[model samples]
Target: MKKIYSIPVFLTMMFLVACSEDFLDLKPIAMETEETFYKDFDALDMTATAAYGILCTRDIFDYYIFMGYASAADDVEVGGENTNDWPQFQAVDRLQHSPMLSTIFDSWGYCYKGIRMTNEFLSRVDKIRATDTKVNQALVDQRIAEMKFLRAFYHFYLAVVYGGVPIADKIVDPSMFSTPRNSLKEVYDFMIKDLKEAIPYLKEKSQLAPNYGRVSKGAARALLAKILLYESSYAKNYPGDERFAGMQERWTEALQYAEEVINSGEYQLVGINGERFASWRNPNGGVGGYRWIFTLDGDNSPESIWEIQNVMDGKGWTYTRGSYIVTYFTVRYYYRPSDPTHSDRVVGGWSFNLPTSYMVNAFGNQDSRETGLHSVPVDPKLDPRFATSIGRPGDTILVNDQTEGEKWFPMSFSNLPTQTISRKYECSPQEYWNGRTNDNEGPMNVRWIRYADVVLMAAEAAYMAGDKPKALNYINQIRKRARMSGNTGYPEDLTDISFEDIVHERRL
Candidate 1:
């Protein structure tokens, strides 16, 4: 097994414990230690890539975080064949999550793995000579900026979950193992500092030099805004929390960063009825923009600010390491579709992250959100997004000509209002998943931060900053798109932007 040292133990000792006189007693280095391995830009770049790669792994992105959010949120339920299907998921859904559960530990472990790698890069890269013509000194510095952002990003994740985690900001030494965990306030401050440093060095979208996967200044600023918002509202529950004394200032900062992303005009929503609509594989394809954002082809879509990338190419048991998003969140019993007009595009579900009545009712049978979640079979015309984003009773949900009315409901026996299936992230129509005889893995990208989220953040920040008109405008933009998905125009009557309005929109 890999080392099980707590972050508090490892990171604390990083600076305190020095090599001292032990060098004389130590044996010669055997493996490619930092002294030899971090020799050039190539080495540091590969190391940085590996650091980022950890987040793309199966456990972190698709399975763990996907289920984690669903479980913790009140809008969803952890459903399977039975209540005992997956204990960890059940625990999270029930709000009885344990620290020892692999969900918690695996997340903690991989995040630190990423942190360690980033620290290693930061510690070594600065040591390279500027005259080293083989390495573009400017590029090396930017990568160093990337590593800094990653380190800060990992700490932010840890802080949100296990508050006040140890700060592994540098290379570790033996004495650092005894270091204590820092306060959440300390951690957030560190993260803010790192992101602020990273934003300037990060590339802009028009640079067109880096591939879509790399982090950009927009992402850094967006993440910084996210951090500020979370911190602003975080301490409300804790009375007299000294760490949040500057909460108002932090909130203003949040508004500033959010506005920066908005004014930059580099990223915007992928309107379902706009240019992206024609690119949805087919005009009659059974999916919408929100649904398409998580599909395999949705990578680097304008809506996506940052996402995890993967490709299967039909090589081996690709699902083993590929994102299992479709594998788990898919509609169950896909192998045996009841539709006669089915196509090879659909796959089955595994009964995880089931939507609940609250989730269904959140949309209140409104524009596209209602159609995206449940089938409006009895009245397809009522839902502008019906049939296009989901299945009606007789519509195709399987290959070559399968129809849906054959089954009682979703998941073999799902009844609406009480128990509903997800139209989002359900791997029913992946065009590339047909290679595997048993569709256990899918190739969809995992979108972490997208333009929709940025717009929402801007809306929230605007409302908090007393600019109700701007907040309403931003929120209306999202609603307008939802209406557009149904081929319906968003009415211009949404003028009152209240705190509840912002919250309700976010819930959708």
Candidate 2:
């Protein structure tokens, strides 16, 4: 017991007397201080990287959640032998709210999380001062503006889904937990304000060389047009009501912004002729040969005003197996284990979403854009898109042997006598699955926002504003591009025709 007596007591006293600094010096093994992240250029880049990282999350485009739900709003069908659970989607298509309403709630949360991260980047980047002036201040401002635009975008998605949401412009402390939902008008105002503020600071088309997908003035204008259109539409619901007196004004603004993009000549719609579809189908073309357009890769395609870059191969949390596209779109041909050509590599087993009979019929039994964009034929006499958009069950499709050949497979319903045709977008053969190969992921690029949609939105706005001729002109442009016969139906020409017909034509 000699001298060991007070050892424990002596050590405890020493630890207490050593001062708080010594204890603080112990430091966390892995914890990082907020200041550490804002120390330099690399740190600022990391912030931007974090903002972009949100796109990889499951709720966004990476999964079929957004597209699946949004498409459900239209006449797109739900059930098939290979299709997944479609109760919520079916309810939405019917305009009936169901228990699946939670799906939209989930989307709301995911989108806000993205906005929060983007907000953080915008708020923190100013604290960083780089050594190089050219790449420091101006670049930082541009990045911050880009993040702001992205934040606005995330909010826009939420607004569309839920009509209202809490706008968080920064990472708030836990003390500020309770917040109420803003009105749809309030949110739209905020979105427009952000875009307007960002336009001046945003990089021009020439400044963004390698990073073409980043937000540009044109992108901001495009989004503004969409916002105005939605606002005007909401206003029109209450006609002759002074409640939304500025509806027409907003529509005029939308038209003006769209005109700006058109006059800028910076972007062009992808021409859809004989080789156009095939060109888009090619993997090597990058953005389907449309530079400045958004695609799966970061490559800047002309059509992509602002796009998120998706990598099939990456490490850490960003790593994607690249099976999402195939799994969601591929038909039974790609998922069946017994098929001779089946590679056994692709994990697709269920068809998550399928076009509805109404949507198919909306194409008016022709090769319209709606059909050509998604379906392939199960019956040769039917639309070829049914075969082009969806895949076939057999190795051979009647006489067609080429990859581009008609591979449509039929879908039967108990209530319906005729088999509904499947589209090529939903079709995939097992032989095409390449496991880890990038090619098997299918087309990675998804247009989160596109000029085509903007055009259609303008057309809708024009129609709502009582400019029937203008509406028809815009609608005809889209129809001509799709090679579908133009609509001769006008309000006066066909008073009995429902507005649903207009929406249907737009969908095509």
Quote the positional error of residue 23 for candidate 1 in Å.
Answer: 18
lDDT of each: 0.66, 0.55
Instruction: Tell me, by TM-score, which candidate is best.
Output: 1
Candidate 1 lDDT, 1-508, residue by residue in tens: 2466676678778756765677567756776776676667787788888788776657666677767656788766776656787888889888898899877887788888899889878877766645345988768767877888889888988887787889999876889977788877788889999999998888876564447667878888889999988887765445487645443335668888887887887877666454344433354754456545655566777777776666544344422445666667655543234456433333355656776655544455333433322212223233334333333233323332144323233234332222445555543243544454445356667788877787888888787778888888898877776665554443223657676666666766
Candidate 2 TM-score to native: 0.71
lDDT of 2 by residue, 206-262 (tens): 567766557788888888888887787778675566434444446777777776766
Q: What stretches of model 1 exceed 4 Å from their correct place?
A: 1-31, 208-210, 235-249, 272-288, 312-321, 334-347, 365-396, 400-411, 414-418, 427-430, 437-440, 488-493
TM-score for each candidate, following the candidate numbering: 0.80, 0.71
- Tell me model 2's lDDT, rounded to 2 decimals: 0.55
